[model samples]
Target: MEDAKLTPRKLATRIGVAPKTVERWLADAELLPHARNRVDACRALKVDEDMIWPKAVQERVKTGHDRELAHAYPYRSACPSTVWGELIAGASTDIFFAGYTNYFVWLEQAAFIETLRRKIVSGCRVRFLLGDPDGEVTRQREAIEDVALSVGTRIRISLEHLGRLGPLDGLETRFSSPEDAVNHVSLSVFRFDHDALVTPHLARLVGHDSPLLHLRRQGDSGMFDRFAEHAEELWDRGVPQTP
Candidate 1:
């Protein structure tokens, strides 16, 4: 549109639509193209419909070489069970995390511990950076999320569940100290080898309500590298879980 030097009104005129319709399309990312509107817009812009719409690309992803390369979950509630299960189950090298409380959900699955144990035996290093249960940060988060269960209590629950692993050889858990720059964990990450599952925080919503971005480390510098770097920095300043 910029190359064509067409204003929104001009573009709408060329596409035979109202100028306001173009504004709405630009504002709402979730909006999909209509049957005739897509064709008209593409014809006017002199670009393929797929260039302006993601659904076109998404439909072909299953047949592509890198099927699980990248994904976007609109909301945490919309994520499928297979997404997390496969990401964790397929990790061959290492697993890293930066989360508030990591136990409530995972421990519910009977195979969660068994899976980690098997991964440890296979030489996958497991590292976790959790928020300090007693910190003011946790208190603030609990109040903000308005959950009946507090963040501090959740962390305590996580420790109890993790303790059941019984002196794992290649597992380490750390708590983020106030001094740590990444102590304010607005985003939670779970990186397994070349893939990372990231959930960034949204205002007035609990962690679980945020969307998840599934990133793969393929190119020289991508989302995976960026998130991995952030996780590593947090890990470096994290305090030992027991300490």
Candidate 2:
């Protein structure tokens, strides 16, 4: 508020709260406004809600599971592309993408192939776990979605992009095994080192429409590790992508 040059009255007016309410919030450090008011105030102040009320944010984390969750998006597309770009740019050891098609990143992320090349050159292990385009699961998903650009086409498109990279050392691709194809197609997990973006597909809904969870690894037995282990198990059982 000070940096934004907003007075209590102005802030309250902007957030649709009483001026006295704003004054009380200012006077009492422990006082937390309603969630909606906090969001509105953050937007009006051009800052993050946590920046203004770290205590409130901390108090909301009731369990170890809650600690692992960094954020939640109503839809995968609701997450900012910059979040993906930053995670990809920042990871040094591991960059694992375990999405069925793994197609949207090619569209949403800028210069992804070059980014992969750089990551591999830096000794990062970059892996893609995709569903086989010709597999029965892909055919079933295509029929279920009934979209113009089918799931198999999307998987093939991702394969084509990966092929263009021409097999960089430290880069790998695999198709999930037949038995695990259903499980693989239902959940998408993309990991960058200790952080991950996960989406569980709803029946009849496309990947973009699925709810997303942004998780940071907090401990060995947290939600992050659970999802990471799931993807790793599928990868272990997967067949290497054939050129």
Candidate 3:
């Protein structure tokens, strides 16, 4: 039943929960999770309250949900039939692979870095394949190495040139050959479990749109598989070199 437009104090008493608790729940990052969960629970309990909620309260929730969706990354899987309904619950995870470095800086994404560190420290397999091996690239690599180490985590990289990439501090770097060759710009995909975020801005800004990395959409697993195969082949074919 919809709430009978009770005042905040009355609603709090009716629910046996504090007003602040209700307000906090409504303000949560993933707000609707509890609404949904509560709906189910109330149905099972056969309890119904006033069916009308105040228009203002409803408007607040609608606005909050819209803001979150516009700002957050999206992922949906048809095969799995699941959605990360962003309510007042919590944020979810995302995995990213980029051919250009600009996107990393573009998002001002300290969140991504921390998530990566958490995944590695928790024993999740993670790797970053940087594009091209040049002198300036080597220095940039060192900076990333320091960042990861400072957090007591490690990032494994498969450098295409140098012999068995180098071991910096405790991080492992190896030179790998082309696992496959391609004539187009591939994609930069960020995955969270069965979901992913794919964008072209990174490669576009850096001018790496060489058909081999044309990241666009994430709804196609077949396309993603093909990209992965090509990258692996190229890495396999590349010869090791030192910077």
Candidate 4:
């Protein structure tokens, strides 16, 4: 206040607050002014808001279990296509699509095969962990969904697209183990390096209809790591696609 040549009354007048309120804010470090008052005071003092109320700024920022969550979509289809394009383009090290069918990328991402080829040629480790089309779990899910485009058909479509890639080095495709089929079918985790898009399939709902969580890695044991670990575990037990 002295540096700004601002008295309690003067600062109060500038921020449109009572002089006693300004005095209270000055008297107690724990007391914080209203957000607007804080911003006005900072401008009047030619300082940053945090320079005056560090605690308030800290309290306003997300720094908990949900800190890693970048976005949430009530339905997977609601998330913008640009987000997927950005994640895929930004990833340089790893791109693991651990969806049960893994068919949507072919439709959603234009020139997806070309993208994968380029990513592989550039040293990215691309992996697809999919469900077995002929497996009993696939049959069961198809019956549950009762859709014209069956679950098994969807898995086959992904396999067909993957087959076209023609066994490039650093690109691997596998079917989740029979025992893990149920769990794999219930959740889809598509990871692009440190960022992940996760979906937990709701009963009787398709993958696109499920809710999605977009997570960015913040720490070793954050939400991103948890989902990444789950995908890795399934991949470890997966059956390699037959040549």
Q: Candidate 3: where are CA atoms >4 Å away?
A: 1-96, 102-107, 111-115, 133-186, 201-243
Q: In model 1, which regions exceed 4 Å deviation? A: 1-69, 181-183
In model 2, the Cα lDDT at residue 43 comes to 94
- Candidate 2, run of 10 with poorest lDDT: 56-65
lDDT of 1 by residue, 1-243 (tens): 898788889989988889999999889887886868988888888888778897865765663434444778878657776777888889998987677677545744457778888988899998878888888777778788887777788888877767876368888999887866234468788898999888887876776788988888776556677778877888887788741
lDDT of model 3, residue 209: 24
Report the C-alpha displacement of residue 2, candidate 1, in angstroms: 45
The global Cα lDDT (0 to 1) of model 3 is: 0.35
Residue 12: error of model 3 in Å? 20
Structural RMSD, model 3: 12.4
Instruction: Note the clash tally of each candidate.
Output: 0, 0, 47, 0
Over 4 Å off, model 2: 1-57, 60-63
Best by lDDT: 2
Estimate candidate 2's alpha-carbon lDDT, on a 0 to 1 scale: 0.93
Of 2 and 4, the candidate ahead on TM-score is: 2
Stretches of model 4 off by over 4 angstroms after superposition: 1-60
- The candidate, 2 or 3, that scores higher on TM-score is 2
As a whole number from 0 to 100, the lDDT of residue 139 in candidate 4 is: 96
The CA lDDT of each predicted structure is 0.77, 0.93, 0.35, 0.93
Output the worst ten-in-a-row residue range by lDDT, candidate 1. Answer: 60-69
lDDT (Cα, 0-100) at 191 in candidate 1: 90
lDDT of 4 by residue, 107-187 (tens): 999999999999999999999999999999999999999999999999898888888985899999999999999999999
